[model samples]
Target: MRILIHDYPGYAFPVELARALAHRGHVVCHVHFSATIGPKGTLARMPDDPETLEFLAIGISGTYRKYSLLHRFLQERAYARRLEQAVRAFSPEVVISNAQPDIQARLLATCQDMGIPLVHWLQDLYSTAIGNILKRKCWLLGALAGAWYRHVEKRLISGCAQVVCISDAFASEMKDWGIPDSHVVRIDNWAPLADIPVMDQDNPWSGQYGLAGVDVVLYAGTLGWKHNPALLENLALALKERPKTRLVVASEGLGASWLAERKVEQGLDNLVLLPYQPEESFAAMLASAKVLLAILEPDASAYSAPSKILSYLCAGRPVVVSFPPENHSAQLLSGARAGIVCSSGDDAGFIAAVKDLLDKPENAADLAINGRMYAERHFRIDEIVCAFERVLNHA
Candidate 1:
């Protein structure tokens, strides 16, 4: 089968899936938006990559204006046109669309016109997330935009040949949206386990970043509107007394910028802010951490499941996640005994969890072991690829 996997964010595991499918004798063309601002995967083709696997980075003229609503909308439309051209050029038998509802909706129309089966690789509920964020920022405009987005998203979901949901929570949402259970398939998100191996704390990447002798609580992903950056600020303030302990955040975007300003204003020398590290340094960066942190606002908990937590687990590090209890991430951490799971608003509990991990090395080690073990057991690429194959072939 010739498959075109369009993952807008270029996440690690999706690239891994492309490789796996290619290895299984399918010709795969994996595409991502190059101008997106976030931690990306191994977007370039490696020497060991299969001959049938091709990676393409489709990009716009300038940086993606994520916060500028009008500019961002124009950019998204431009990106969709470029994406459509790429799709027409490849003309694969099956298309798996991930992230970016607006872009995916455009692609859906193209696929229908071309008589190609397009699978919706549902990662996040963009409409709900946008609604929550916008409503908080501006009520009337937010409601109007939110409703428009919701309508578009519902059409996209229903129009797709298949929907691959990342969590069971999403399946419930699908049901509420009047999507048939037969149209939805639950395939949990995962990390590239092989790519993110467990590395030593004193590795070259850590040394280069001056993380050699520090007790680091790190958050290394997109800190966007769906997240509460204040939690990170509070965590940094809480760790002020411990000179050796550092709050390292490796990210870019509005939330990161806010944190940067807060770091300076509060004189938080203990807060170390860095842009997203290169793909090669990712594992080592995670290794340098005593505890990994992830956050999701209560509003986002229903729709967005942070894939960073999976990478944190793959790095063999204890994780401290702040999200709602019912979130798949929280449930996964709780069930796997990976680390501590605190509610989004529980700043004190989150602080205590991080401190506990830092203070009790033995307990942290145990949690790290459990997390890695769970990843090893469940994140088998062959199994995941087979599951994807079933859906793609059927579609």
Candidate 2:
């Protein structure tokens, strides 16, 4: 099957999927948005396939950095024309669209015109995400935009040959939107595990980062409007007495800024804020953490899953998550008995959980092993890629 995979902000799972598909002898053509933001610079990149033409980067700016909604709307529409032409030229049998909220209708229409089966890969409920991001200022505007987005989302899902949702909550939401269960496949997102092998605590990267002999509770990822950084503040306060335990934040953006400020103002000696590591250092950085951290605003969990959780598991570190129990992240941790899950904002509970692991290194190691095995069983890259292959072929 000639499969076309589209993921804007071209990184992570989709790229891995494309390469894996090509390796498996599928004629995979990946179309990605070309924009580099955040530290992991290759947000857009072509898979290394010299023998076969397999990857194409569609030049488009997907990030809305303090831009007016009108400009963002115009730019994406312009980009859609180029993307549409590219898809027409490729003439793929199936198109799997991942987290593509921009110019969605146009993409769907283009595929429909060519009689190509379209698979809507639902990563987040963009309608809800936009509304949540907007409700900070005006409720009425948020609601109106949400209603419009929901309508479009419903149409796209209904028009698709199949919908692949990354979470049960998202699948359930699509079911509410009248998409039949049979048409929706529940395939969870996975970390790029093959590249992230478990390293020793005293690995060179850990020593280089000065995390050699300390208890590092690490939070690494993009923490946007959906996450609450105040919890990190609370955590620092809770762990103030434990001089050996440090909260290492390897991230950028407002959340990282807030944590840095807290370290200065509150004199959180245990809090260390750093920028996102180079890709070469990423796996070892993750391995350096004694306890990896993941958080989601309880409500945001319905629409967003922190793509970093599975990565943390593959690093063989016990995770400490602050998410609603109902969220899949918490369920995964609990099911594997791999980490501690406290309700978001429960600083005392989170502290206790972290402290429990800190005090008993053996227990933490056991939890870490469980997490590693859980990821090995459920989040293998080959298994996930195969699942997607079956869906794309069948669709």
Candidate 3:
């Protein structure tokens, strides 16, 4: 089968899926948006990649203005046109669309026009999330925009051949949107275990970053609007008492900027802010941390699950998550005994969790071992590929 996967963020697991499918003799073309600001996968082709697998990065002419509504809308519309052209050129039997609502709506129309089957890979409930954020900022205009986006989202899902949701909560939301149970499948997200092997804390990358001898608490990913940068600020303040501990944040965008400003205003010498690290150093960067951190605002718990948690598990580290208790990520941590989970607004609990890990190295070691074991057992690419093949064949 000829398969085309448009993963807007160009995440690691999707690239792993594309390679596995190509290795199984399916011709696959993976496309992603190059201008997106986040930690990306190995987008370039490797020397050992199968000949049938190809990668394409579609980019806009200017910087993406994520905070400006008008500029963002125009940029996304322009990007949708390029995406349609890419689909036409590939002419695959099945196309998987994992993107924002605006791009998904346009791609649905393109698929319908081209007489192609489309699989909607539901990563987040974009309309609901957008509406909640906007309503907080401006009640009247936000309500109108949210209603319009919800209509567009419903129509896009209705037209798709299959819907793949990342969590049970998302699947339930789809059912509420009137999608049949048979049309929706829940496939949890994962990390590429081979790409992220467990490394020691004193590895070369850690030494170069001056983290070899210190206790490091790291947050490495996109710090966007949906996240709470204040949690990180609070962590930094708490770590100030421990003179040898450092709070290292490797990220970009709005949240990163906010943290930077706070670091200056508050004179936080222990806080280290850096851009996203290169792919080669990812595993070592994660390993350098004594405790890894992830955060989610309460309002985003229903729609977004932090994919970074999976990566942290693979890196053999104990995680400290500030997320809702019932959210999928928090549940995973609780079930695996891989880390401590705190409620979204529990700043005191979050800090205490970190302090506990730092104080009890033996307990932290046990949690790290459990996390790596869980990743090895569950993140089998061959089994995941078979599941996806079943969905694609039926679609």
Highest TM-score: give the candidate number.
Answer: 3
What lDDT score is found at residue 9 in candidate 2? 57
Off by over 4 Å in 3: none
lDDT of 2 at 382: 78
Task: Order the candidate numbers by TM-score, best to worst.
Answer: 3, 1, 2
Candidate 2 wrong stretches, greater than 4 Å? 36-50, 60-75
Alpha-carbon runs more than 4 Å astray in model 1: none
Q: Supply candidate 2's per-residue lDDT for 140.
A: 90
What does the lDDT read for residue 355 in candidate 3?
A: 94
Q: What CA RMSD would you report for each candidate? A: 1.1, 2.6, 0.9
TM-score of candidate 1 relative to the true fold: 0.98
How close to the true structure is residue 207 of candidate 1, measured as C-alpha lDDT?
88
- Candidate 2 to truth, TM: 0.91
Tell me each candidate's TM-score: 0.98, 0.91, 0.98
lDDT of 1 by residue, 12-68 (tens): 899999999999999999999998877788887789888999999998988788888
Worst 10 residues of 3 by lDDT: 127-136
Local error of candidate 2 at residue 262 (angstroms):
2.6
What is the number of backbone collisions in each predicted candidate, taken in the order shown?
0, 0, 0
